[model samples]
Target: MTDQAVAAAVARRFFGRQRELKALRADIERTGLDTLTGRKAPRARVLLVAGKPGSGRSALAEELADGLTDRYPDGVFRARLTEPGGDPVPTARVAQELLAALGVAEPPGAAEDELTELVRRAFTGRRAVLILDDAVDAEQADPLIPDDPDTLVVGVSRGPLTGIPDVRPCTLGGLDAKSAIELLTAFTGSVRITVDPQAAETLVEECGGMPAAVVLAGGWLAARPKASVADLAKQLRGLTGDPLTRTFLLAHEALPATAARILRFLSLAPLGRADAHTASALAGCSVSAAATTLADFAALGLVSAADDGQYEVPGHLVPLLRAQLEERDRPAEVQLAQARMLERTVRLLQSCRAVTEPEGSAARRKLAGLPRALRFPNRAAGADWLRSRQPVLLASARLAVADGELDTLARRLIASFVRALAAHRGAEAAAPELYGLHRLVLDVAERRGLHRERAAALLNLADLDARTGRTKDALLRYRLALDAGRAANDPYAIGRAMESVGGSYQELGDWQRAGDWYGRALAQRLARDERADQARLYGRLGAVQTYAGRYGEALRNWRAAAAGYRRLDDLPGHARALSEAARVQEYAGRPEESLRTCEEAVEWARRARDTRLQAALQLRLADTLDRLGDPAAAGLHRAAAERLLESRAAACEIRSGFEKD
Candidate 1:
């Protein structure tokens, strides 16, 4: 069938989206209404049909194009941005290609705006439909959209084109059961469907209303002439027990031997917003060869254009590809190829995250063959690379874990990415990301029975929990980590875990236990000559003593902390020492010294931009003001404290001493 014919056929038969189609039609009508009302149309010229890899996005785009065809007389233009292997074609190339389709004679150049203006002019004064298929994002597709009032540009993509603000995004999801069944019946004989109606219905349900899988299942039954629909359903159940794979195998198995191997290899290929280079590497061929293979797959509806030159497996086909990959009993050659595939992606990840400062020759060897783009030309480029590849990095970690290689690689990947992310985004901002990484790291470590890594992961997780006020859970995890550290005979880890456990106890108002643990942690720090850390421990110990009304002991510890900080020459630690000592003095009714200490703390705070320290000093001044009977000044300081607390909750060193349940 011709491309346009197929696109038209796909549009006409779009099913079970009566409500959604109406909403889309209504949106389209609104655009027309604005023109008729002689008012300015919404500045948004782009119509985005956004959804995941599958969920019938192309069909929706085609339907919208078909709906607008009679109104658009200039001509309908369609461009595919992804190749079969899910690689992204560049925007410049796509824009140039799109212009060519619009009958514009123009040289592609570095000037993006000039090209955009030229493309917009081609469709001027004529109503037309422009379908931008398999777009990577708005940056890739939005440039091609016409500014003309008569043009309707529909972009199909796996995710939101967040870069565009005014584009009316019509998000598509999976097919409903009725549509899935109808899709299945289109391929399978109706006689077979009606003979065992219940089984066919069950089969459709099993496909999760994913049209591709349903059609594939029906296709498999079509090839098996004598197989009853019930029998085929059972066979499909055994095929992968997943709608995605169940259908993928039905079609993949029908391929010639070489193509099937290529398909499975493509399945294991690093899927991301990829470029032609990765797709070529996956196909074990040149870029042109991979491009041709991608075109073939697009023709078969098994792949789509993800971007200008990128091709991808249909989203729903991923699971099936994975299933097909796992089922094949391959020789060492194939296994080596797969390992190389993984290594290539690992290189990409290292370039994107740049977490591992090369530890040895082997690490360097593993990363040597990466694309130069991964090296990041500048710091801004590196930051942008990490942001651009974040999703791919996460998917790589998950793929490794799912493939039972977590013990070897996934833990390190999670830890390295987690650390990198934390460094880029300060801990307070990245708390949620850190929590997920800790969970994944711990799981991999436990699965591999690597106690040291497990303990480290547990400690990190406990810290997040404690900071979030889940001290009880934090206490339990910190103890577990401590036990693991002890089992490994690691003094540094054990000491740190002890301090974490103690901190949790302190938050729960268990001063005696907090003192004990802090003492132990301090002793370890002293033994290790970690004076900087020791000073912080002493401050924590002093705060617990003060909160328990042991003013003298608190002063002794605070003074010791002050001496330690002075020796270490840490300004922040020095400020904390002064603040704690002042609080202890105030509790002991030495307001004169307390007032002097708070003044020093405020001076240090102003230099440091330590709002928490300023808040504490303000509260302390308010307390002094109360004792001296200065009502208005005290109330103003109290209000300032409240505002600071609300604005800087995470940065503030809150004195939380909740009673244990």
Candidate 2:
């Protein structure tokens, strides 16, 4: 269904909260509607729709937002401020999500404070409504509230945001009896509700008039058309505290044994959401069976089914389900179940990346051997699966690492996550999360005394730092990684760490130290006969030498890199190396020689089918020709270069459109 259709369906079923909605609307308009006037207040109006779990506060906030779309024409951006595990989501991550929802381009690799500031600035001039759900405290909500009076911020939290200035709080409780009865009538139909008004009232009382519990009771009653409301009320007659919990327990007791077990394991799902695969893995059942059970649960309001085919256990239901899991399953048994689910997740992540490999590649062959259900059909399909499942996949990694007993599994999970994320979303795009996951891996490695993995993790973190221009910080981590590499006797890590240190020094303009580190790294690669590393280090040395005014040495090193690429049969790499040589030739005041070299580099780039490289080389040729007193030839080359770049840009735009679609 379209989003509007779904929202309409929900609005039709929504009952009660009339008075609360009125109060909330009043509170939102207390400072006057932002859309009405151009007058700017000191800050955005913040209204806290405070309630306990199962109080329907989130729904109320959604209803209010839906009604106010006309008032906030700019947008109604929503963000969840807490994780499924009840931990507060970091303010920076929340801000990042908000920024995306606001159609703002977040600066990649930005610090937490910077992202928070960006989010605030994005909403400054816009007349919009920001719905922050499940916020735990003032800190989580405060950073997100915009300063513009033309905007409004509606926060759904457990209680008052104590430290937030001028915040209006609307605490909620049970729905009124009349609205409660009407809600029951909608679920079970008016005929049954009308015939037994006393029984319906008893059931409402038993549910404590909490909208969520009443809905559960009504659903349970509706499912058994033969059962009366009094029957459910009698079953709950003597139950103690928390009507929602009691109703959940009663509904759980009625489920078939397998369904009940699956329901209990649902609590183990990452972020309280599970699809058929998740259910099948957790319950040791077939996907079809799991899907059927989930559908039934959704019908009974035990879980909410999203359009994407995943079922979400209601926030109030998670604790109840967890309680059932603890009562019925052993600790070891629970751990095994979690392990199975995580293992299945890892296999899925593997498949998600493997489908992107060449058809006859080893990864593709391995994918073919997996179950048909696990294999994706194509690269696009694989990427889509990875994108859709990233949240759960990341959550699973966190849980695995925090499990503490699953260090080996956690390491494997983190590795697969890194590869999958990089395959689907480029490394630069996934760098922020990758940095954190690498830290988790480092934590595990340190705890287990695994020096090799420690070096690898440190190197990964250092590379991200280097990417973001933190040269000094990256150099420190590279040095530490080098130490770990030596301790582990990992030759590859040692070479990479040395080369990276040199790169950092080059970025910091310490040409002498950079050259020294590069030479040290070169020696190791040469001793091991690692041609690729030798070529890479030579290029690194060439760059530092060029920066240090050793043009002759740079030209020689670039030529050597070109030769290495030739031996390795890497056309694109060969082309790039030649282009570098041509640039250095021009820098050395040999324009005629540079012209000839650039022409050859352009041919090589064309042969390699590297459009951007060819265009760059063409531009270099044009510059050299212009310097050599050949304006006609220079203009011709310049036009050719423009055409090449335009084609490249157009191709990139097309590819980006496909990705977005």
Query: Which candidate should be chosen as best, given lDDT against the real structure?
Result: 2
- The lDDT per prediction is 0.69, 0.85
Off by over 4 Å in 2: 1-12, 32-39, 103-109, 358-362, 550-661
Clashing pairs in 2: none
Candidate 2 structure, TM-score to reference: 0.86
Best candidate (score: TM-score): 2
Worst 10 residues of 1 by lDDT: 652-661
Task: Rate residue 428 of model 2 by lDDT.
Answer: 80
lDDT tens string, model 1, 1-661?
5432342244347667666667776776564545678877653367778876556788777877776757776677888787444667666556666765676655312246766678767877768888889988777777777767667777888877887755677876668767777776665547887888898888877777766766566656655668787776676677755576666766676776765666666666545334444555555666566566555555445655543455556555765566566778465645565555555555555554443344345645554555554454444565665665564566566656666643565665666677567655556765655665677777777787878988998988888777766788889999999998998888878998999888888889999999999999999998999888888888888989988889999898998898898787666677778878988898899988887887787677666677787888888878877886887988998898888878786444343323332
Candidate 1 wrongly placed segments (more than 4 Å): 1-260, 269-292, 308-312, 315-338, 354-370, 373-392, 423-428, 593-661
Q: Return model 2's CA RMSD, one decimal.
A: 5.1
| Every model's TM-score | 0.55, 0.86
Model 1 accuracy (lDDT, Cα): 0.69
